[model samples]
Target: MILKINDLSVRLGGSHILQGVAFDVAETGVTALLGRNGVGKTTTLRAVLGEVPATGEVLFDGRPALGRATHRLVRDGLGYVPEDRCVFAGLTVAENLRLAVRVPSPDFDLVFDLFPELRQRAGQRAGTLSGGQQQMVAIARVLLNPNRLLLVDEPTKGLAPAVVTAVAAVLERVATRVPILLVEQNLAVVRRLATDAVVLEAGRTAWRGRAADLLSDADATRSLLGVGTTAGRH
Candidate 1:
């Protein structure tokens, strides 16, 4: 395993946000962290990166990663792409990528391979790009940083279907190099990208198993995910 969370709990503003959330992520595949909104999916990612105060055993490569600063985590081969596409508006795409360039990893070309449009718009200011393009910049910037483990929170949020497909493809290619823990609400994207899943409900893990098993078992999906008539309805 590349990442492990055991008996992790986090409280924010006097409310318990993570109730003993636990999961494991391997080095060669994608693990989807699925849940409805306000169920601690984002909070869990933040807690893992030490962005929020929490008590947990977050082991990365068997070393303690909990309570470590975000920059330290980045330095130790962990990359985080937040739900909000946080590209520096004033900087050009190439500048943003250059800012994250680190040593000992010459995989910058691979990012271009995954996101070819970014290479074409390398000279454009990040803020001028469309939402989809900005997202690519945000993800690509981290790849330039040369991290091994990726924590991606909601890459498909608010994207058009075509754009979402493009981003998913990029993620799949990126997964070939590093493990991913993806927090996603889109069941279709989750089905396509995840090898395994951990379903969260009200800050606790509700179900843990292979994605295929969960998808095949409709009762498990409806029970654990609380899928009602509203789900997948147009």
Candidate 2:
């Protein structure tokens, strides 16, 4: 396992948002974090990165990862792509990607290869770009770093159908280079990219198995996610 969370629990603002959330991420391929909205899927990722106060054991690369600072975790080879696609609005595309270069990597060519438009729009302000372009920058930024695993939260959120397709293509190429712990609601992307899955329900591990099994079972999908087929796009 590349990542492990044991008996992880978190309370924020007097609410127990996550309780005993536990799962394992393999060393390669995407592991989808599936759950309905507000079920603490996002919070679970936050806890692993130590962005929130939590009680539990988190192991990264077989080392105790809890209580570590976020930057240290990244330096240790963890990458994060927030759901909101937090690109530097005022910065140009090249500048935004440049900021993420914590260490020199060959990924500059790799990222641009996956997202050629990023190279084309290298001079454009990020805020002025479309949602899809910003997401590309967000994912590409992390790839530029010396990262072993990527924690991606909803790369398809709010994107148009065409944009989702494009992002999925980029992510497919990216997974060939590093493992991905993906938090995505789009079932189509999950089915195509995820080899394993950890389903979250009410902030707990409701189900865990191969992505193929979970996705093929309709009842389980409806019961846990309250929506069938994360499949989208026209």
Candidate 3:
């Protein structure tokens, strides 16, 4: 397993966000974390990364990961692309990527190859780019380094149909190199990339199985995700 979460729980301002959530990510391919709105899907990802105070066992490559600082965890090969696509508005695309280089030699070749538009707009400020282009910068920032696993949240949220397909293709290519723990609501994108699936409900894991199996069961998909198997762009 690339990552493991056992009995993970989180609380903020006296409100429990996650209650004993448990799941595992294989060392290869994509694992989709699915849930409806406000069900702690994003919180689960944050807790694993130590962004919030959490109590539980998070094992990265079978080693205890809790209690470590977020930066330390990131330095230890945990890459994250947040939902908001938090690019520095004032910085150019090239400068945004440069800031993410952790190792002596960043994988510029791979990043440029995956997102050629980023190279073309190297001098363009990230804020001026379209939402999809900004998302590309966010994903490319993490790809600049070598990571054992990636935690990507809502990569396709609010993206156009064409851009969503483009983003999914980039992720599919990236997954061939590193495993990803993805928190996504877009079932179509999920169908295209995810091999394993973990569904969360009200802050706890509700189901775990093959992605194909979950989607094929329309009843389970509707009950848990609040959407039919055909939901989202297809």
Candidate 4:
């Protein structure tokens, strides 16, 4: 395993945001951290990155990872694509990417290959780009680091359907090299990218199974995901 969370719980403002959340990501696959709004998806990612105080075990390849700072995680081959892509408005696209690069890496070229629009407008200021393009820049920034594990939170939020499709394609390409722990609300995107599903209900692991299995079962979808029944199966 590349990353493991064992009985992890996060407390923020005296309330438990994540309760006994446990999952593992391998070196070569995608794991979708699926949950509804305010169900602690972002908090879970923060705990893995050590952004907040958390209990229980966070192990990277059987070694203790708790209390490690976010930058340390980055140096240890973990990349984070935050839910809100905090691209610098005054900086050019190239400059924003340069700021996020941790070390000298050929991985920057791979990012441009995945999102050609970034390559095309490398000189343009990031603040002027469209939402989808900005999202690409955010992801490309992390991709430049050559990290083994990526903690992606809500990449497709507030995007148009076509833009979501395009971003999903980029994520598919990224997953070929990096193990992605994707926290997303869109089932369509999850179904496309994830091999396994770890569903959260009020910050707890309500269900864990193959993405195909969860997508197939209407009852599980209704109970855990609050979605209407559908006939789709991965």
lDDT by residue for model 3 (178-229), tens: 9999988889999999999999999899999999999999999999998977
**Local accuracy of candidate 4 as per-residue lDDT tens digits, 1-234:** 888888999989989898898888777878999877889889988888889899999887566888888787788888889999999989999999888876865476688778888988999999999999999999998888778789999999999989999999999988988899999888888888999889888988888878888988888988888885452331
Clashes of each: 0, 1, 0, 0
Candidate 4 has a TM-score of: 0.95
Model 3, which residues run further than 4 Å from truth? none
Q: Is candidate 3 or candidate 4 better by TM-score?
A: 3
Pairs of residues clashing in candidate 2 = 187-230
Off by over 4 Å in 1: 104-106, 228-234
Clashing pairs in 3: none
Task: Give Cα-based local distance difference scores for all models.
Answer: 0.86, 0.89, 0.94, 0.86
In order of appearance, the predictions have TM-scores of 0.94, 0.96, 0.98, 0.95
Better of 2 and 4 by TM-score: 2
Off by over 4 Å in 4: 229-234
lDDT, candidate 1, at 109: 81
Where is model 4 poorest over a 10-residue stretch in terms of lDDT? Answer: 225-234
